[model samples]
Target: MRSTSLTTGYDIAILGGGVAGCVLAARLSEDPGRTVCLLEAGKDYGPHQQAWPQKVLNARALPRDDVWERHAAVHRIRARILGGSSCINGCWNTWGSASDHAEWSRAGGPMWTAPAMERFRRAAVEQMGLRAVPDGEFSLWSRAALAAARELGYQEVDMASPDGGPGYGTPLLNSVDGLRWNAAFAYLDAEVRSRPNLSIISGASVDRAAVRAGRVRGVDIVVDGQRETVHADTYVVACGTFGSPAVLMRSGIGPASQLRETGIRTEIDLPGVGAQLVDQPGIFVPLTPTADLNTSLAAKQASGDLYVSRMLIRAASALCPDGSWDLHINPTAGPPLFGRLPPGEYEAGISALLMKPASRGRVRLRSADHADALDIDPAFLSDPAGHDVAAIRSGLEIVQELAASAALKSLAGPAADGHPAQDLSDQELRDRVGTYWHPVGTCAMGTPDDPLAVVDGEARVRGVSNLRVVDASILPTAPAANTQLPVLAIAEMLADSLRG
Candidate 1:
């Protein structure tokens, strides 16, 4: 990694020191000659700091308030810290299916073919210290869930496997020694943090990119209650789906009308900046577990041993052909509740989400102030193709069925929802549905001619220079698994491009 520099212009200014930015900063600093500045809006604590917040480091689960919680009518969750969502997220290190990448490759980014993406996936997983739990440690519930899926003709497989074909498997996690191994721990570890060339500036909220003459020159930031400008030779905006667009629009880039309506002068008329907001639609299917299930989990939590909070079954959607995978049947123990047990309660449930949602929404400026929350609308289950609704509802049916299986019945009971899963109406499903929190495509990947294409496959903004969007926002479509793995893979691939 490069050493810290006492220079005015950094070689690269990475906005948002979350999953992508942290990795980007560490990798880019590898050049040694280039100076990289990583700016994060939350706390950036050292690994050995006397008081690393337990909520940020524990392997239990993510805290609910650890991210931006409210957006329009949806209860959104976006990590605001240096490690970003990965710090707060369920550490399920799973990848998109090969077919998923093939579709992306066909869609303008031939470079993202499944075969080509393997290297990046391997690298990210390795960097994050992801590993599978030993067979001996698999929770009885998880093991029983896997057995039930197999009875349904689903094979058991690791989600991180490159083949990535549909199957039920114990999720591989980055956490080690009972601590959630986040991006900061993976890329910006002790050795990387001590580097002089890589400076991490946290607790500073970026107001906007400083764009001039069709190029990004720097960023306006508020730190210590004082505003300052930091210039760089190039800039990378990995500030997440909502934030990247908000930053661009605040800098006078976005839908011209929206910017003008928000009382900001438009420097670019890229209406696509915040247009294609795609998010996976999901909901929890709670079930009453057999007695002693809660007791076992509580004892395990008390033991301080790594516990299985997540076990997933990746299956093709009903809409997907025989050999394609698209739905994620995530049966989690403690995650949705974020590990906060309510006075001896410890029942687990399934969170079924559509891997590929057709519904599109928007994220636009609600005000000109950077501090003001942006208006967000995921518009989930509104897919004209009815794809999202069909996929999630189908997955939930399986969850209900899986819950009813003899194997799972020994571990857990029937659905505890007001109505049985099969009896759920479309409107009831919509009302019950919540987000999987894996949102992307707010800055879509398409050619300039595409009206909603804010950025191309190269990750460049359609009409801006020296600027790029590298987080979940640029995914042409949602991947077939949990998002942290895909985002890290995206960052690893982008690192090669930026370094090259």
Candidate 2:
């Protein structure tokens, strides 16, 4: 697995071949003069194009057939590929709140803001066309939600601009030819992949950043068996918040006390390295719609109505902010009861998502191993009394109103959990609220004065030179919607900074 040429020791070394890594490699290699080495711990997606289906079920949920099962106990995500999580991720591309970006700018991420993010998104969508259809069936849930909002007298929430920050007009999907087009196919296509300047090494796990004179000179990576060093002028730890922290801790560059406990010497006492994790709360409410929505959806999809339905949802803004996730209300077309079916049984679920959660959590190394998944304490519901709770609670109340709406009520039965269709008590509702799968801010980009700051606004790890973290780890907080678009935009912005 170790193939090296005297000239291949690149100008830049990118760890983690995810969306950010692919974009950086592509953009960096665009300048043929520069040498870039993209190292992926996961297997290359070059073999299985079948994993690129737009539908969730068709895409490969697990990693490579060989490596997936081994790492199952740790990271539940299907991240062992060139495209990273984008490969199996739902293509919900709704860019989150401008206010969230503004907060990042104020905290430490100076380059990230609504306008900058929008500009980056514009570029990305220009490359991957955005579809927004108001009457489309994919957006039926959103339309229903909007109708519910209207009926309840609550200010209708847009996918992007939850409280008038940025307006999410349509559902933006990462699809090419109506099929799922991940970073491997979209950003790092054959042309980029074939570049001589860009050398991609898959299945190579990075152990630690080799620090000399307080600057990153190379990395200690475990290839087939023995350890080797890959030197680079600039080292970008796009291994994500959790991965970055774990690598840093392993490299003896983290909290002094924690390092001592592991019997490792301290390189840098960055207390905030694994602190300040953030994710939005998720709440789902089941509705007994008048019709069998799931069966109808399956039939329509089978009948070539998939595109039409998706297009309709796109236009309506019912889809998640950028087609990165879905949060519409649709009735289940299949059997209502898991055990036995009641005739004409149907249930549509309405979900309340914070999109941008104000709460933050932390990621800590459970062990010194870089391959080990960090102990993630997302600390969901960290601030139950904060605005975070208010937003989620408001969304829940809105869904209840929507379920009671004449349009849905005329077609559906009473709102229930399906087994027994009864109204949930206030306590029952609060207990049921959960997470939306958007975890960020472990290595938050903020100033040292800020308690939650990890990397500075420039994405540079505080007190460390020649090392930059360019992933969702640097997010100051969770965005209003799906994080892929924002994370990609941040990487683009980081690439520009690195280029300069």
TM-scores vs. true structure, each candidate: 0.93, 0.81
- Cα-lDDT of candidate 1: 0.79
Where does model 2 exceed 4 Å of error? 1-8, 47-78, 133-169, 176-178, 289-295, 304-347, 384-387, 415-431
lDDT of 1 by residue, 421-444 (tens): 657777888888888778888877
- Candidates' lDDT values, in order? 0.79, 0.61
Candidate 1 displacement at residue 331 in angstroms: 2.5
Off by over 4 Å in 1: 1-7, 69-74, 306-308, 334-342, 415-418
Clashing pairs in 1: 3-196, 3-197, 4-196, 4-197
Candidate 2: tens digits of C-alpha lDDT, residues 109-209: 44666665566666665544544432443434444444544454543234433234322244566754345567766677766777778888888788887
